[model samples]
Target: MHAAEGLITGLCALACVTPARAGNAVQAMPVDAFLDTLAVNTHVNYTDGAYANVRNVGDDLAWLGIRYVRDASPGSGAAPLSSYVYLAQRGVKFNFLMHENITQSIEEVTRLNTAVPGSVAAVEGFNEINNWPVSYHGLTGIAAGLAAQREVYTRIHDTQGFAGVPVYDLTGFEPKQVESRVNSADYANQHVYPQNGEQPTYEANGDTWMGNAINGLKKYQLPLVITEFGYFSSPQAGWYMLGVDEPTQAKGVLNGYMDAAAAGVKRTYVYELLDEKPDPQNKNDGMHYGLFRNDNSPKLVAYAIRNLTTILNTSTVQRTRVAATGALTYTLSGMPVSANSLLLRKKDGRFVLVLWNETRIWDRAKGTPLSSPPAEVEVDFGTTASRVDLYDPNVSEAPIASHRDVRKISVSVPDHPLLLEVTPGAPPRL
Candidate 1:
């Protein structure tokens, strides 16, 4: 990967032992909310290499339970005329990247929305503008980008087809500076790739709040969109950021999603769905950034994500109105400094407590998993459960551990995400 393309997520890690903070209150969000925030980047429009060889993107996406992908507009000419129509027809939504020609972008999505209504997930401005600066009509650099951004916002919002669509702001610029300028968009955009294959919470610097604050993207008062972020599990490629193994990639990406959500990002699209080039020798840094290999083979990260989505998928309709419900409180103890938790409620009223430790687990220099004793975390909802289940995506779809009629459960965390299901028993009716 290029130096300019790296993502600095600002997730920090502490080496020494420090007690994880106890929650003052447990805030619960719908599981589907986090699932919807998870998205992947794709070069489906590019007709070359693995992208050219693989034709079952829709199938792969369905298997992963991922409904959205990031792609280039048809008019960009890097793609043939209407190349992504088939994928759109398969109920796949796309966040289209706008090329130089804004008119072509409008026309392309118009055609798409006409064929497949609501096919457009979002419209992104120029990517990594710091590296690939835009020169627009005598205007150059940030000035041109700002002009084009305002134009895109105006055109997208004014048009009937795109009136309801959200326009994400451009990346690779001073977000703090842009807030006062003409940064026109509904959502603030960011691209954060954690440094040195670090844990998603592992901050390169002393500041642990970087992932949440994230170069001041959170301060914009607009919903943050992580357009591009992921790890390339290639050790052969010599770069400043040391690449990790495939297992570490899986854990890091999953941990990254949880971290991003906890940080309040509206959406996160991991970079590139498939490795475009097949570097058998593991030489190319960019080639291995995919969840799938060039041959469309599944990586550990892909399976874990699949498992996660499958466990979260429910057949029940979404609750339109949130009923009067009690807030469930749970005591978390013995959590390491890197341990984190998120509470999610299923439509059926089951609570899913996600526990993961973001402590460093990959020895980048040795290219091996850093071995350490599993840290145990105990959680007690203070109410007996009628149904208790647990799932570790890296293991299998089925619950790897389970308990019933118990209010407390102890689990081990080794840089892995564990989902615990608790259907708290109802209070005794008078």
Candidate 2:
């Protein structure tokens, strides 16, 4: 049974609603705090091109999540500790995973704290203990896996150097099976991938499949962290197919981040930073799950994420009200008539309105990008603004000017997200 069954039943008890009309009466939440919950998963070796790719995406990542020790063998003399030190020197904080032998994992954590005191943000006991090889205890059953994690959790906390550092429970792949065992550590950690090929939409009360998994863990009342969540671009033989083209991957990622934040997750990490090498014999060997391609070039989704983090992370934001009528209601050419928006007041007193159409942009049956003519969207800023700038996430150029001294402005909205900046009085310094 799916973990969302309980959440679905609870929501049904409240009301039954359709997708387009689901969040019509919902109130907006603080975007700045939501952005603070964003993080990207990365494997940086410093020697390989991983470091450069991480540096590029680091501005948006809250912190890095890497293996407690390097992925290389102990005899490889790769010096993974030095790489951790390098990241610290470059101002990159991290949450290290302990999936190796218990003694070595403890020694590594001790060494890490000694090298850069208070550098490690959180230490996870193990990873995906329900699955073999990845599970340090090599236990297949949930009960045994929890017991092994409990031991590691106790050992890590009892170690001399890791007193104040928070230790997270092992991240299980299935939420329902491990929800009861999450209380063994300081915080609850889980990995959720909503790869059913549906757009991440929420109910009147913010809820999605991912949100339901989070809600399932709410019984423990522990701080939650989604250690890894993302979609792949190609399908592997044994794994379920959640692959989409680059653009859809970008949209799914952005939607996933927003949904997780709305669910009140403390932190979220996208699967990876760069695409790994695909198997030569099988093209779709499930290795291409990175924001950047294997050659170290940025994908469309990379720019989308960068644009989102840039706009949302730069300023502190508080939720505000916007009258949704002429300017805010948007419709697609032959698609759904719905507008998704977030209204935020920046710390500098300027207002930012983010808007996007809810129409599907990808045809799963045909496996191609869906196109629609831009819909015009207008919004009343409540007061005459000195300047208004419109930014398209698909493009990386400067924003276009909309209008001056007008309280209301209408602009064409695309399937992708657009950022609108409205200054209340004279244009503030950019």
Per-candidate TM-score against the hidden true structure: 0.90, 0.71
Mind giving the per-residue lDDT tens digits that candidate 1 earns over 1-430?
A: 1243545534333231222244444667788898888899988766767776435677778888888888777766466545577788777888988888899888888898888889998898877778888889899998888888888888888888776789988776776576553348888887766665566665324534335345466466777878887888875233346677888889888887887776677888887688887788877778888888888888999999999998887534633232226245778888866777777787777777888887776665566666567679887766666667888988788888778788777888767788887777666568
Q: What is the lDDT of residue 104 in candidate 2?
A: 71
lDDT, residue 206, model 1: 50
lDDT of 2 by residue, 92-180 (tens): 55676665566776677577667877766677766665454343245555555676678777887778777776767765445555546
Clash pairs, model 1 backbone:
7-193, 11-201, 11-202, 11-203, 12-201, 12-202, 12-203, 13-202
Q: On a 0 to 100 scale, what is the lDDT of residue 298 in model 2?
A: 74
TM-score of 2: 0.71
Candidate 2 at 341: error in angstroms?
3.8
What candidate 1 gets wrong by more than 4 Å, as runs, is: 1-6, 9-25, 181-183, 203-215, 236-239, 314-326
Per-residue lDDT of 236 in model 1: 24
Question: Which pairs clash in the backbone of model 2?
Answer: 327-378
